[model samples]
Every structure is written in C-alpha cells, then in structure tokens.
Target: MNRNTFVPVNEPLLKGNEEKYLLECIRTGWISSEGPFIKQFEEQLAARVGRKYGVAVSNGSVALDASVAALGIGAGDEVILPAFTIISCAAAIVRSGAVPVVVDCDPVTWNMDVAQVEARITPRTKAIMVVHIFGLPVDMKPMLALAHRYGLKVIEDAAEMHGQTYAGKPCGSFGDISTFSFYPNKHITTGEGGMIMTDDPALAEKCRSLRNLCFKPEQRFVHDELGWNFRMTNMQAALGVAQLEQLDKFVQIKRRMGARYTSLLAGIPGIQLPLPRTDFADNIYWVYGLVLADSVPFDAKEAMTRLAKLGIGTRPYFWPMHEQPVFRKMGLFAGESYPVAERIARRGFYVPSGLALTDGQMEQVAEAMRKVFQ
Candidate 1:
C-alpha cells in the first residue's frame, strides 16, 4: 500500500442484495414509507433480534425519542444512563420532560458501571437506559435485576451491537424497547435509518403511530397526540432488508477486523488498544479505538491530526454528556463528575474498522499507527 493512500474511518459493505432490492423499489415506485419493504425490513430485523415486532424510524436518535414516548416515560420521571454514551440517549429522556440521571462507565469495558446504578435509583426513577458502547454489551443481568427490583422500564440502545449476544441472549431482547441505527458506518446500512424493537404489541403499535405523526388509524387526518414525521422510506427499508440477510457475515468480518488489528498493534507504547473480548461478549470492533496512556503528551484531537497526516483517517470518542456546554447552560449535571467518561473523551480515538476495509487498508493503518507511536 502506498504511504499516501487514505484509509477512511468507515465505509459500508453493500455487495449483497442492496442493488437488487433497491432496483425493485424503483421499478415498483414504492419509494415512500408505505411500501412492502418497510414491513419486511421491520419484521426481519425484529425477528433477528428476538423481538416480536420492530418499528422502523428515520434514524437512531428519533428511535430513542419514539421509544421514550411509547413507554410513557415523561415529566417527573427520571431515567438512569451512562455518562459515556451519545447524547441521544439523554436527549430522549430530557425531550420527554423527564430528568436524565447518569452513571460513570467501567474503565475496562467502557460500559455503564452497573454497580453505581443501585445507589442512584430514587422514587422518581422510572427507567434505565442501557447503552452498549462501541462493541461490548453492558453487563445486562445485574441491570435487569435492578430494573425488576425497582419496577422500572429498560431501554436498550443496541445501536452498535448488531448480531451481538450477551450470555447467549440477544442484546436487544432484554429491553422493554431496544433501538438500533442503520448508519453507513454500522454493520448494516440503510443509508440512514433506525429501528425500535419490543415484545409488547401495544408498545410496537405506539411506536408505529409515533413514527407517522401519531395519526389516528380510523381517522387518518385527525391527530389525537403530538408526534413527529419520523417514518423510514421504502427505499431505505429496501436497503435494510437486503442488508439484514448478510448480518451474520458482517459480524464475522467485523470480528476478524478487530482480531487482526489487536494482533497487529499489540505492545505499542503510549496507547491502549481495545480489550479484545469480555467474559460475556467478544468485541465486535464497532470502531477500533485507542486511548492515549497518561504518559502521552497530546489529546485525542492531536492524535487524530497525526493519523490524518499519515493518510489514516481517525475519529475522536464521544464527548461526555456532562461536559457539554449546552447541558451546562440548561442547568443539567452541574458540579457532577464522571472521571472515567471525562478521561476517555479527552484521550480516546478510533482507527479505520469499516466493513468495506480491505486487508491492505488494515495493514496500512497498522503501519501508520506504528509510525505515530514512534
């Protein structure tokens, strides 16, 4: 590989039935949300995750919003989640007029510290939002136990854990409502889409209604409640249906990429590689991230700059929700601290680990990583 060849942060693998299904959507003129592929994609993905029904939405963020609304978690309610996850998790709760209570992540697994959750529970806490960060599933058993004990709802954010399992159970199966993203960087891509999955038929119907502006079934034009037009188009669902067929293969590819990177970049100084596997689940390498050791002189932004100069694309980790200026101005999480989340946000970054990444590109990334450390 040429030293100047750029290895992107992510790219989707669409060599499966993506083209065929997309063409069918075009030929049939079923490009809208009310197409056959929409239901097919929903059913297929739901079944894959061991859910009784799936509601397709425009994107992952809205899926969270829909799930929060469907669960009837709103004002005066509090939802406990991790400080280390995307803002969408917290935003969903806040948007519903509920308060978001955050817990720090485990240093090793980068998942919510389940031990901290029990202490945070209060009379007003109505739900727990468990977000599986990167590739590792959050320690679910204890979280579920807590939810059961407290009579609280569980919302599983399995956006990065497609085809991933936790102790022989599917990641999405545990939540009252679980959500997934179909971004291009994900294992499967609907170009841009998301889904909400659940075993409860009423919850599933509520999500479907919410996705389409909460219009009444009997009276289509009459609106009873507020909702957003978060419907997923048939074109997107066509891509999703095709992509679902290849999920197992995609998971394998992701695992292999993770393994190869771990082997290639082992023993490098000044950086910490992702833990290859956990007791409950293997790392899917959602993105092959690295954390700068304390000895490193620069932050993740600087590391990303260095990698970019070497033609190796990289991305910084999620900024902690507590540190966001917007949230601070809004008087949320004031004076609260999550050391693990803060440190990782400053020091963490990920290298190329896309499904479309070629072996040559992986080697190129490895070589670039070595040069960066040297």
Candidate 2:
C-alpha cells in the first residue's frame, strides 16, 4: 500500500451538527468564551453523565488540576493514581503541591488496580484519581467503597470514555469529580475542549471559579486567590454540543471497529487483541491495542516503527510514570516498581481504530499487520 494511504491511530468522526453549530457561533459573533452554546454544552454533558453540574474548561489536564484544587488537596497531601496513564493526572496532583502515589494497572482491564490503591493509602492521602483508560470505566464500586471507608475523594478522568457505563450506571456518575476531553482523537471532537462534572454544589462552584480565574462578581479583577485561565471557548463548546448529539452512535461504531479488528487479527500469533466486553462494560474500542506476547521478537516500539513504514499508524502505550525522568528528578516513586505496568509499556501498541475508519481501512490495517509480522 502507498504511504499516502496511511491509516491514523484515531480520528474524530464529524457526522453530525458540527458545521451547523459552528456556523451558528460565527453568525452570532459568539466565537469566544461568552455564548449560549457554552451553557448548553455544559448542561447536556453533565445531564448525560447523570451529574448535577458541569464546569467547562480549556482542556482535560486543567480540568483535573481544578478538581484537585477545589477539593483542597495541596501541600503535604497525597493523591493515588494509576502509573500507566497520561501524565496529566499526576501533573495535577503535583501542581497542587500533593504527592502522586502511583499504582500498577490491572493487566486485563488496563485500568488502575483497586487492590494496590488501599495498600498505598497513607495518613495524608487526600484522594484517588481514577482515570478510565482507553474507553473502559475503572471498576468503580470497590474503589468508591474504599474511598468512602477512608473519607477520600474520587476524581474520575473519563477522558477516553464516552457513553460507557459500569453495571448499567454512567462512567462519570459515581465520582466526587469527573473530567472529559473533546480532542479530535476522542469519541467526540471540538478541536480541543473538556468538562468537569460533579454532584457536589460547593465543589462545582469552586471548579467554576478555578476555571475562570476566580473572578468576583462584586469586584471584577479583584481576586481573593489566583486561578488559571482555563475557560473553554464558545466555538469549542458549539462543536462539542453537536458532537454530543451523536456520541451514542459514535460509541457503537467504536465497538464495531474493535470487533472487526479482533476478528481480522484473531490468529496472529504473539499478538493479543482487546476484549469485546469485560465484567464492567463493553469495550468501546478507543484504540485497537495489540500487546505482543513474551515470545514475540520485538517490543511495541519496534513493532510500531515497522508498522509506520508499512503505512499503518500505530501508537505505543503509556510509559510507566514511575520510570519517567521528570518524576525521578522529583525524587518520587524512586524505589517503587510496578511490574505489570513495566511489562505492558514494553509490549503494547495500538493500531487504527478511529471513529471515521472504514471497513476497508481496517482491512488494510490488518493486512499491514500481517506483512509486518511476516
């Protein structure tokens, strides 16, 4: 296949009112942060997740930061999270002057290991940041139970998961705070945007303040405390509202893509495909990840490089946070080792599983995989 035909790892499917809403924003001159679309998007997104309130933000990372800040977790505090996630989770805790105590992920679910969470809890533990990895919800019942028992907050990073549920409940419904991203590669695209959701009114107000730079109504620009400029634009929210209207359909397409990839690559030795459904919820196929068996000749990096050469886009899994140079320089998790995370980081890579991917493209991707293996 020609390199021009390369299939991307993930692409947003804009099959709804994106253009229509964007045009409306332009017509009304409400392209910036001020517009009705912002409130509309927030209300719909929060309601979709069964939450009472939502705070729109500039991006997913800052949403996490604001949530941690709103909970009053700071200096001398600790926030436990999965070691095999995007650095945003840890960055938030660290930015708030809290220690990020990382844990290993469950090998099967590729989510934070609940059992390890309690073992890492300390007297100064403030919260457990639960990031739903690759469109699957964390097994939240146990995690929530543990949090309640110890009076710890749960911050749900539902960035990669949309329209996914656990035991028939929405993914974002259980946490003290839940966050979402609307990057182009996510289930929905707003170019770049995110949301923070919660049932707690006080927490919601705090997050809202934190997102808007803590502006006081009585005296504008006279702030009691400092907050970052993390407000989402009305244009982005317009795109999000349009995308949200079609999110359920997008999720169905994602599952189909996963199933197709699984069937097409079934007998490829030394490569493991994602499960269609786990005990918690059906896999939304955020990415059709392939994990090489121990017998494989090369690790995920090498495999991804070869796949790229064959016009197939592949992304390696998150490198274990404990092994990150930046974290090591901070003298955190210095002697700690997460064996499962280390192994997965070495072996895992995801192939094309975009929302806009066609059956033919997936076939090409599978064929390219076979060529690489051969």
Candidate 3:
C-alpha cells in the first residue's frame, strides 16, 4: 500500500479560465439562472453539439425529465432503457410518468443492446433512452432504424460522453433529444448543471418553457401548465462556458490515458479491458473499465477491497435495474433476467482515470492491480 498516494476513481479537471469565468460571473452580478452566461453557454453548447437548440437546466436528471416531459410521455407509455446505467436514467423515466422497460446491455460496449431493445418494444413503447456508458458511444444505426420502424422517439443520456462521436456524427446529435451532465466527475464540470440538445424547435421550446415553470410569453404570473423549477444559475453556465472551451483537449487527454492503460495491462490475466468500436470514431474514456474474468480467484468485491487497501479507489458497474429494491416493489420487471448486465455488475471494476491522474500514478495503480490478480 502506498501511504503517500491515494488514487481516486475520478476527479474534475478545472483549468484554463474556470476561475476567470467565476470572476466574470461575480463581477457581472448575473449569478442567478437568468443572464448572459446562460445564453452564451446554451448557444456554444448547441453549436458544439450540432444541435439547433440547447436548454440549460439544474442537473442531468432534470434535463432528462424535461426532455421526456417535452415529448409528452406519461402514464400508459413505456421508455426502453438498459439496466446497466445510473439510476437517474430510470428515475427520469419514472418522473415523467412513463414505464421504464429494462433491457440488457451489450457485453462489449456496456451499452443498450440494440437487439434486446427491439425485443422489448411494445405498442405502448414511446421512446428509447440510450446511455453512452463510460463515454463509449452506443451503436446508433440499428437503434435508429428500430426507432424509426416503430415510430418511437430516442433520448440519448449522454451524461458521461462529452465530445464522443459515432461514425462521423456526434453522440449527442444522433437521437431526437440528448441530455448532458456537467457534474464535476463528468468530462466537463459546471459544479452542478445539465443541458438538453435537440433539433426540433417545438421540443426545444417546450423544454425551455417547462424548465421555467411553463410560463406563457403573454403573461408574467399566468402559467400555461404544471412545470418544475429546473433552471441553471449563470455562475454554473459561466463555468460551463469555460469548460466547453477545453472539452476537446480534455477528451484527448482521456483517450491517451485509456490507451496507456490498455497497453500497460494488455497481457494481464483475469482482466478484460474495454474494446473500442470502429463504428464510433472516438471514445472519451470517462473511466477505464475492466471486467474481471469469471475464472479469476476473486470476485469484483474482493478485488475492490484489495485495491482499497492498496489506496486505489475503484467503482463497480451499475447493478441491474430489475434487481433494485425500488423497481422490485414497483413490480415493473419481475422474473426478468438481464444476464449481461448482471455479469458486468458483478465483475467490473474501474480504477482512477481522472484527468488529474499522471502516467506514473496510473502505473502505480496498474502495479497494485497486478499484485492483486497475481
């Protein structure tokens, strides 16, 4: 165990104008949700994402909820999602009053298996929420074809995949609507914020109006419909503007780090490194994930314990949504088994792959891993 070095799973990289943006926000006195920074951030992000409109919100979950709500999805409708992602994806669907249909993930990409998604669609299926897990872009061609055939909308949960591309198109631009999280651990940080991107002007307007309490343009106090206050502060938008300016550079660093880890751990036994997909031109490796082989002497928990003792932090993949207690009580996914998601959850462990991590630090973590698996 290295007492001097404690490698965390992820850390935010705040450099190159973050402080300046904060200072600018403070000086301008537009720290609230309404200001020039928010507008600027939305426009810049829209352009960067190749979308016609971008709606800034309080957080990723809220952005997702807004997008779903904007689509008019509610009770009697179903949204298909993979069981191997953050709970927020399911939460957003539930909040929008839609039934969440949990599907299996592709073992290779750890993303929604397009084949499984097609199998789960029903007459009530209104949308599909595809998460770009671990910054790897999901194969959208088949998913898009399925959606088109079924007349289902697609909402991309691109929280972890900033600056990632599928073929030549950006990940966030593939679906009908895409949501991003600017949380500290994500590729970019705005302290706590989110953005929704869409090419549909009507959907974009609905998102913007829903975020601002569904206020009508003709009246100040009159509300057209029920809505939540999911607005982002100008301060956060300022940070986001600065963060966006350096997103490409940050993604490049992440790619290099991922490649280095892959090279260093290539021949190591009992470890399955994430494979890059040619369909996706770039992968902004948010966390360098490794799946423990079933033949390994230890389970993912045991490996995590050993790594923690070695001062190396690790995180397990998301537990299958069907197995969660909340969803269990809801009885939405009874007797359903997503074998791939369950296996990944039990065997996957991702170590520190933050932007702040140095090559030597990664080497040290890899050494510790080698010691554990040996």
C-alpha TM-score for every candidate: 0.98, 0.98, 0.97
Q: Each prediction's Cα lDDT score?
A: 0.91, 0.89, 0.88
Task: Name the lDDT of candidate 3.
Answer: 0.88
lDDT of 2 by residue, 25-81 (tens): 999899889899999999999899999999999999889989999999999999999
| Between candidates 1 and 3, the TM-score winner | 1
Q: What does candidate 3's lDDT look like per residue over 1-374, in tens digits?
A: 55568888877888779899889889988889978899999999999889999999999989988999999999889999989998888988887778999888888888888788888889999999988889678889989999999999999988988888888777799789999998888888888899999999999999999999988899977996998899999999989998899988998899999899988887889898987555656567888899998899778999999999888988888888888899889877888898999999999979898888899889989899888988
Clashing pairs in 1: none
Q: After superposition, how far is residue 251 of candidate 1 from its true place, in Å?
A: 0.8
TM-score between candidate 3 and the true structure? 0.97
The lDDT, on a scale of 0 to 1, for candidate 2 is 0.89
Candidate with maximal lDDT? 1
Error of 3 at 362 (Å): 0.5
Lowest lDDT sum, 10 consecutive residues, model 3, at 275-284
